[model samples]
Target: MSPRDRALPDEPDESGAASGPAGARPGAHPSAGLSDLSIDLTAHEMLRRAHVLEALGPDWDPVAALRDEEAAHDLLYSGLDAEQRRMYDELVAAGVLPRRGGGHAAA
Candidate 1:
């Protein structure tokens, strides 16, 4: 589902306003839910691990940065939340991506 479709009950609707106060919201608390939008460790570590991974090299290699495809993918997806992963998997299953083909395809 799109972000619009996933709007919280506290979020503004088409009319644009939730029928509640600030403290009355569901996920309004700090310790409640999803407190980690800036929690992409693998991404944050990329620049720090650049010397080890050599990601900025003339020949950027995933094999060196990450052992194999699986490991590389693991690191890539390590940043995603459950909902994000689910959406990604669903898109993959549907044979579509956010970028649906700016290039020619066989079929």
Candidate 2:
């Protein structure tokens, strides 16, 4: 390899090392591995449970419940780095505010 080539940084293509299922060109989205789109079931279940709890208002304390939701969001982002954690928190906070209704929901 030429010295200049060695010194020059290598730029990753737009596909970024991704490839489709059939060993096709990385540019082909159809061949992207299924694992890349995998969902974390535990996190999914936790969020679902939180939603159910939110819907079951009479049985849960509003402040405490929001805390639990925050914690769950925290747990979900535990695998992420610092910047990712902030982004996750931002997403969670966006939906965490209480809904406005003039009076309590009808029984």
Candidate 3:
């Protein structure tokens, strides 16, 4: 039978008790038979998350955020001390970093 045609094993009653599957004990927890991996979000929590995304607005650019992160990284690593430059050169020689202009690694 198609999945939709099959009856659910445990349906909730009006009072939120489980009218459970065959061989299940009466008045067992509503989620007794469910997987622990599932997430249960209340209506208010779902609406809060929706509002947070909506507040980010249509002009929000994930790419711009990435570019800003890259800029910050560059600013932080722009000038390396002599010891740092030596370690960077060693990393490049070890194939950990790609070689860049003037034997420096890209920030």
Best candidate according to TM-score: 3
**Candidate 3 lDDT by residue in tens digits, 1-107:** 45556555675333334455644566687666666686677988989988988999989898999889768756755788888878988987888865655667443
**Alpha-carbon RMSD of each model:** 21.7, 18.7, 13.7
Tens-digit lDDT track for model 1 on 39-59?
Answer: 558976876887765647778
What order do you get sorting by TM-score, best first? Answer: 3, 1, 2
Worst 10 residues of 2 by lDDT: 98-107
Question: Superposing every Cα of model 3 onto the true structure, what RMSD results?
Answer: 13.7
Give the alpha carbon lDDT tens digit for every residue of 1-107 in model 2: 45544433475433434433445555567635445566669988999999997788766688897889867744644477667656645655576533223211112
> How far in Å is the alpha carbon of 99 misplaced in model 1?
18
Clashing pairs in 3: none
Model 3 lDDT on a 0 to 1 scale: 0.70
lDDT of 3 at 23: 41
What value does the lDDT take at residue 13 in candidate 3? 39
RMSD of 1: 21.7
